[model samples]
Target: MRYCSIPCRVVGALLFGSVAANAFAQVGQQSVPLSADDNAEVEHVWRFAQETESRSSLPRAVDANWIENARLGTLKLSGCAAALVSADGLAVTSATCLRSLENWIRPDDSVFVAGTLLEERKLPGLTARQLVEIREFARIEEASEDLETGFEAELIAADDSSTFWEYVWRTYGDVRLVVIPPADVTDFGNEEGVYPRYAIDFALFRVYDGQALPLETESYFAWNDRSPYVRERLFATAFDANTPFTVITLSDTFSYNGTISPPHTTLYGMLDQYYSHGATGAWELTEDWLSGIKENDLATALNFSVVGECAQTGAGLINVDMEILGIAFDNANTEEGTRCVVMSTSGILALLRTVLKAQGVADELAEQALP
Candidate 1:
């Protein structure tokens, strides 16, 4: 995604008083101390956003406790989704998450079981090992319409979730995903016909062992695809209070047009992951409903920035009450800027459905769907 920093003052007017309470009020006065469900989902989304921002802005050390408690899974062999696809022993996540591994592995390498937890943790440091690249069924070019239409990728694993986490911890365990979407699809397209199509904002993939890590819990934002585009106020909190909470007023949708073809391919592949910010966390309005309000401006605004010095990879972008918003995909330090990107809940849901369908597990989940 394109990186440009605007003077905070340019957004000061729109951001003024755009806190969670204010956004909630604008939506409607429900109740303070939101219901249990609301609290979990909302808080999850809020913290995820803050954690992502914090990683971008500073070199905050990863807490061991936080690492131990995060959910662990892998992406489907090609697409950017992460979840425990089966109890019988398969884990799913995104291919991009494992791209580094794909680059190094040799074809003749053999897969071996690492005896679950303790042994698996030591797998990465072993010297007598060879990296193996598993062949996937799809390619990026095949999935896109042109140089711009986004492609879908997936990752498949034979190991269970526990093994997944163990592998992550041993190799690269600190990461997060955040989801953001353009207020309107038109803002993402260009005359070349390259545009941002609607998809999940972000998803998380963490490593684990036999025990399932508690997934980030919070009250989730309800999907409102039909809601008209408006300069709505939104709020997000940092995982650490030392960091300032951000309140954004999405004034107007900005357009981004680019090619998705090798070096550019990685950049193109990441556009969805890159621009997946805004409303990734919990949203609220004040009780009076008059605070944190902004109108769509003609200037068309985009909120994008990197937290200096922080490695926020894999930190959860949560809403208030701690529901999972998405995971942090980039570390600011690596690029001399915040490298975080997010996918939305809807994007995650789609991946979940797709992976489950591929694994033939969706039928079971469908039977237990909540009313």
Candidate 2:
């Protein structure tokens, strides 16, 4: 019901399409009363997947691919999520991760993202920087034979379609990560039934070697060339709100094409994992531009889809199958279960390839065997 063992710091959402339109909206403008947990005092904060006091006990806890995925690395945005896409240091994530003008108010706003948006979000002098730095994609042992070369990445381009964005890591990195969420956070909204898979929340990056060259490692996620079918199992991973690594799964084949009521709403997808939080939206859209209140911002992200159409865009996406995170396999069907929704892999890949083409590196994509 709540989004965390940790507290929720949901903020007001500002939704605008064309800068000329200047369409503004707010989420739950009515002040939500903060519970003791919501308003808890200062304490330590370690991001997801980063070292933590409790990490030592979980040794052999995650797969080596996870480390590779980690090695592929991640980009730190004030309020967004991202991951390494290639060994040469390409990365991918939702194009709208940082689309929120509200997030650019910080002093470091000039750090690089979108240039034009910066000007729009701020004063005349503000220019956006697309490139950002990525730290370790994975951890190498102090004594490991492979040396670690810390590198910085550059943001080359983002597709105009907004379905996916692309960046290149100085070097490349990639690894298939099998995730097991255990007790975690899914934020797919409490007791809500609609699935939000409209953001087209995906991106691509090229990871280079430490020397800032093309990556040649065997550790990349193959393009999964084959189209996804209903009722198939897909493993998906997402970096946590902070240092945690999260993987969620779809228990069975779910659909929305013409099945659920309201024809356009009611997507059938659920996280086969456990999460403490409910969903958050990039923009809450509906038949009317205002019905969506914090759902994923497909309107802004893709510049398509009517506002409020993807009204439950918690963390910008909900998709695909198999519950892998935790050792706690009770399957109680308790409310604690993660209720999520995701777009079909076929669809995700189609959008991704478009970004790849724009980046001129479609060949860099791994070869997927037809299923």
Clashes of each: 92, 85
Cα deviation at 254, candidate 2, in Å, is 6.6
Residue 287 in model 2: shift from native, Å? 21
Residues 187-234, model 2: lDDT tens digits: 223222343333333433333333434445433333332322222222
lDDT of 1 by residue, 231-275 (tens): 332222222212213322222333233432110111223233334
lDDT against the true structure, per candidate, is 0.25, 0.26
What's the alpha carbon RMSD for model 2? 18.8
TM-score of 1: 0.30
Best by lDDT: 2
TM-score of each: 0.30, 0.36
